[model samples]
Target chain A: MIADYGYVGLFLVFGIIFVAGALAVSWFLRPRAPSPEKNSCYECGEVIKGGSWIQFNVRYYLIALIFVVFDVEILFLIPWAVIFRELGFVAFVEMVVFIGVLIAGLVYAWKKGALEWQ
Target chain B: MIIPVLTLIIMLIVGAVVLGFIAVSAMFLIWWERKVSAHIQTRYGPMRVGWHGALQSVADVIKLLLKENITPSGVDRLSWWLAPFFAVVPVVMVFVCIPFGNIFGIELIARDLNIGILYIMALTSICVLGIFMAGWGSNNKYSLLGGMRSAAQIVSYEIPLVLAMVTAVMFAGSLSMQKIVEAQKGLWFVFQPNMAIAFAIFIIAGTAEVNRTPFDIPEAESELVAGFHTEYSGMKFAMFFLGEYTNMFVISALAATLFLGGWSGPFLPPVIWFLIKTYGLVTFMMWIRWTLPRVRVDQLMGFAWKVLTPVSFANLIVAGWILMK
Candidate 1:
């Protein structure tokens, strides 16, 4: 196990070195050329406009909120599903309850207009 | 003295073969992507050169090599160029854990580590960081946005991806790829009722992780115009291209090794079976890429966090309870 992790670590180091080396080589080999027009933000060659970093919609946050609820539920379900045959009726009952909780969240999202698109 | 020299020679030859395979496979996959996409859209793809454009990628490579390397002013020169190398190296490293055949057979794998799954997972994460660097270093706003999107997408999807794998690990009771493959000798994990759910989650998460279609908001060509690598040109761009294709191969191979019974089949060599299964998965990925419309960013995150996460978690609990009993 230790050796396995070590190999992964070695690979990471190699990755860093390779990337760093390439950048260094390119910096030296490539010619340096800078102009205001060249450095300007590219937007179909139109003249420069306002800042490009405005805040996006809040719906994205709502979607993330809904996702959190569901994602956790899925994590809880995988192991249960794996051993379902062995666990019998009792396990099934527990899973039903779990799914019930998830369904409630989905229903809640659906009702709250969270799932609707403009 | 002879034995040591012979061992050294063998090691060099093996390394060369592996590197050669990585390069050739990546090139072929690039060509295949263009051809497949062309056919899907009702157009002829690269039929001019080397029998139905087999050498088209080769021609493209030469062009990229001959093209002048451009460096934009005010960009972080070092990081801008380093990005591509960072993207490709981890992909090459992932092949080490893949078991192509049995011990008595070719066993084309580079290394078999006990924590193979985790190792690949960790290495793949570095690719994200590379993109991040590329975006920020390029001094371009579009590239920065693309990089940020990639980072967010990767972070969100990675959780479910790992969770899905946990289900397999819990069932197989091992983290080693070879051990995982061996566990499926009698029955592949995909056929298991509970494992089926996990497998589905894995496929979806894998697609997002590699930034492939519908989930490809990071590099949305229509929107970002090539995303984080927008400023790159020539051979540097090719490296990123190679990296992306290699990543696709890694994810497909991983899916095969984990759920489809890696290197286990009758009437064929294990390596051939493994490749066939892997390529099959790859082709499916390509199909999805061409068929589905690119999803909006909000929808992408919603699917990951809301749908996939909850389903995978529920699957996990069910797996745990079953194991307990």
Candidate 2:
């Protein structure tokens, strides 16, 4: 198992070098013609507005929170799903119960209007 | 020779081939998408370059390479400079595990990692971090909005996508791509009733994952003026574009592997079968991209959270029950 992950590490290092090479090629060939106006952020021909990274809606964060909850559910479910056939009905029931809990969470999120976009 | 030197030689060979595949396929897919979208709109796509514009992407690449690399003022130079690599490198890492084919009774895969499917999914998600960094690093409001939208969209859709993948994991009993393909030797998973549902959900969620039309709120030209990539130009923009198309290929290849049975067919060679199925899905995605319009942000979020996630979760549970019995 450790050996398997060793390849991932090697792949990652090589990948970074390869991407850097692609960028280096572009850097060598691409022109350098920066100007005050050219370097400004594009706004469809409009002048600069307020800061771009200002506070936005809270709904996205809510959705992200809900996703995390389900993500954890999945982490538990994957092992169950992988070994599912060998475990038979007992594991099936266990998974159903586990899913039932998540479903309840989903329903609560739904009723709470956490899923609502508006 | 030392063991480390031997390993290094093997890695060098594999890395070159995989990177070459990525670079070549990205160029081809760009030209192909243009032709497909052009024909969809009833226009001549690229007639001037090499045999009906097949070489158009080659020319485009040259132009991008020669164009000025613009670093917009007021940007966080660190993330700005590194964003393209972040967008690309992870995707390239995924190629290591993909089973391209078997030749002379030897598998053509790079590394064939045991945790292939999980590893690919994990790496693909990291591309979102790069996009967010690009938006934040550029110090542009539209880029930020685009980046945030991408984050929201990707996160919301990932559940259904993973759940859909889990169905296949259940059927195959392994996460290795080659084993998944081998498991489907008897029958492709998409043929099963529940597996069909999983396949459908996978495609829908996969479409959203890649941020194509109907799910492309992040880079909606009409709304965000190129969205998270609004501030990027020239070669940097090219990198993003290449990453997006290559990502499209990766997901399609995943779909092909899980549902359609990677590299499996009669008469044709294994690699050909794999490419055919992979590119067929790629073409279908292009068709959908051209056929559909972008959805509202609310509608997109609603679809993922309200509909897809629930249905896929239920599907997973049901598939599990049936398999268990």
Show where candidate 1 strays beyond 4 Å: A1-41, A47-118, B1-12
At residue B284, candidate 1 shows an lDDT of: 93
What are the per-model DockQ values?
0.18, 0.72
Model 1, B1-325: lDDT tens digits are 9976775566555555665777788899989988999999999888998999999988987776665566666578788867887788888778668787654556666668866776777677778877888887877777888987887788778777877787788778776788889999999999988888988888899999999997999899998988998888766887788889888888888889888998899998888899999888988999999999999987887776668766876787777666667
TM-score, structure 1 vs. true: 0.81
Q: Which ranges of candidate 2 are over 4 A from the true structure?
A: A1-3, B2-4
DockQ of 2: 0.72
Fnat per candidate: 0.13, 0.72
- Best of the candidates, TM-score: 2
lDDT value, candidate 2, whole model: 0.87
lDDT by residue (tens digit), candidate 2, B109-139: 8877777888887888888888989988988
Cα deviation of B254, candidate 2, in Å: 0.5
